[model samples]
Target: MVHPNTTPAQLSSILRKCAAASVLGSGKQAHRHALVSGLIPHSTLETDLLLMYARCGRLLIARQVFDRMPHRPLHSWNILLSSYAQSSLFHHSLALLHPLLASGLRPDHFTLPSLLKASAGLDHGRTGAALHALAVEMALNVHLIVSGCIVDMYLKCGWLVDARKMFEEMPEKDGVVWNAMVTGFTKAGLLAEAFNLFQKSQFEAGDADWMALPSVLSACSQSGDLRKGKEVHGRAIRCLVLESDAVLSNSLIDMYSKCGFLDASLHLFSRMRVRNLVTWSILISGYGMHGRGKEALRLYEEMRREGLEPNSVLFTSVLSSCSHSGLIDEGRAAFVSINRVYGLEPSVEHYACMVDLLGRHGRFVEALEFIGRMEMEPAGSIWGALLGACAVHQNVEVGEIAARKLFELEPGNPSNCVALCSIYERAGNWDGVAEMRRKMRDLVAVKTPGCSWIEVNGERLCFYQGDVSSPSSKLMLQALRGLLG
Candidate 1:
């Protein structure tokens, strides 16, 4: 019960503390005290209660409190909107804008960011653009935080050209803005553009922001640009940036591993002063990538010995390593350990890895049985793995079953149709191949052509299937044919 002499100021203070600490039970009690103390209609108290509930993730109760407020302030609306956006309730967050504007309250710099974030979360570029226009009209677009959100929303919605325009037009670019564009380019698979921006950032700022380094390393890893990767690593060292950043170090380990320098990855892993589960997972996955399942398993055990619990991600790597090496027994043991030893339920990825392992070894019967016993509905990856294995083993019967399920689950994926056609061709079933091609044409399921990238003379070149646009294409194709012959 609230003390007889307790002031509204004290109650507000108590509610603020509850919100900060996420003490929902205490916050509820305080709400009760305020109601009993005849503070039910207190504006400050009600807003605090709303904020408390929102911060505690009790959005329904927060909305209830907000509805009861006779005079809702713009600050209260922002709190609720931000809460919804942060919780990824994008629709609910956007819904608040209509009521907020209808109530004659205009959105401020604080309001647009949350709404823009919600737009980004929903991939609603049009909604985000409208918010940008609103910000411009309100003269709030020039605000640093609001401008950053605008750029981020555009980038996340895949409007890279627009994002670049906004980024270039910004009168002042902070580290956050620079990192957003670089990271956006990296995620969009424009690695060269990402690296070029990274270089420009370094030149303009006189030092690379530690935040953008990971994205650059990721680009290097994706493109297999070991030369650029080494340049980045050396720059990190020279800037003394890698000394204190575990994330940056982990990215380096991943880069070296992807570049086929397993020893260098291990050496970096060993010298690290701190190692998280992700660090261990990266190294184990690197070993797995090199088809060293035994080494990966050994590291798994070592990580366990050091008292680090393995999560689903680590188990996926372990299972993948076993699949690649065809270590069925080891894969079984590791799959069983996920639930029995570690008390972690197997994810769809672990199930997919198991299917791949069994199907690759021509154990179709056991693989079918395994799928039958799955606790959850098998996802496309699981069936795709089985389908891929069918193509490898040239098993037309099992391939048909897997492909049918894939067609239903992923109608847009042409790879499954293509795989079945390949299986039919290998089995000398011309009729089946013709039927598959007809189905592909009917569904309009066009397969994306295979592409490969190589780095030479500090430049990355890409070659797609049947691509002859390059000057050296004819000679390269002749050389490739000779090698095949």
Candidate 2:
């Protein structure tokens, strides 16, 4: 019943249609028939076969089919590039674009977006800018695809100024474009800008029922702006967006805690109809941050009792709580149980917490040995903990060793060098102290400035270590002088 007139192009079109329709079973069966009938040797059929394989997540088979293709089309190249990008192989994705260009396939608007996205994921901002220039050179600037990709790339790279400029220059805007701008501002700690955009998207009435509210709320959490955070929460409640979604709920919990409203956070957590691991982790991290270690541990027990398993992040939070509370044995037991019981690998944060816990309890030697015995490389934080302990115990020799190790690990960090200098001064070794300071000036040149902030009427005001630009500064000084007289 075979039709002799049917060509390989027709058969490949049918297979691609089936794949697009999500009828994978039938497509696979057709593929087997095509191969057995010697029809799949056609280049057109090979493209369809590679796309089918990639769609099914059989990347190895996809790559094999792609390599065997006698002729490749731009569409086939784009499919493989997107596959690698989506699979988080950014370098592979970017590198594949080269061969596509070499094959005389001029990248259209569709091709550059995925490439720009991959470059962003890889933090290759220079490559991203070069792609933008190419897009302009190719006269693809008006393409929504190119514009949106640039927005996302700039956002991911934390270049908010460039993102805003691109956003402003666009003749037309879309929801995705606005979302990218809001997300970028939020991630870059520009709470005011994110909030303004969120408000503007609501037709300028301050309703802010837009999708950007969640991201703005995240920025408020970062800035610890409680007043603004409450406003966003109220808007979420009115919009009916936070009740059912676990991620939003977890974010709210984190936001409330960061704003110093733990009671509200606990209430919100308890009232959550569904809770995920992130929910428990957020509350635990909140408690740890606020020095409520006992509450955090209690919640950990409750989490386990409720049939939720602890992951590495949860264990790290609990270990941090133990460090804050000087619970050496509890921290040690939890560290061991993370791998032994929960099958979670301990990260560097857990190791640092353990060292801090032991060192805080005056067990300096044990902390040093613990760092030495770690299965992973001991990071600077661990050495810093031991050095701080030596400072507390006035152990000059141990302090010197810990400081040296920390300096080696983080050679450009001035804090470690300064700590060693202080330890020498305490030990009356003026020569050693002078040498440490001189080394700090030479090798670790940067100084971390003091930071201050004030919250006034839901707005934040920041002051640097030596700033005196406040309007009330002169008045405060005069009032203090009058009180002294």
Best by TM-score: 1
State the lDDT of candidate 2 residue by residue for 240-313, as single tens digits: 87887777778789999888899999999999999888899889889988888888899999999999999888
Best by lDDT: 1
Tens-digit per-residue lDDT, 312-417, candidate 1: 9999989999998989999999999999998998999999999999999999989999999999999999999999999999999999999999999998888898
TM-score of each: 0.92, 0.88
Report lDDT (CA) for all predictions. Answer: 0.92, 0.82
Task: Give the least accurate 10-residue stretch of model 2, judged by summed lDDT.
Answer: 201-210
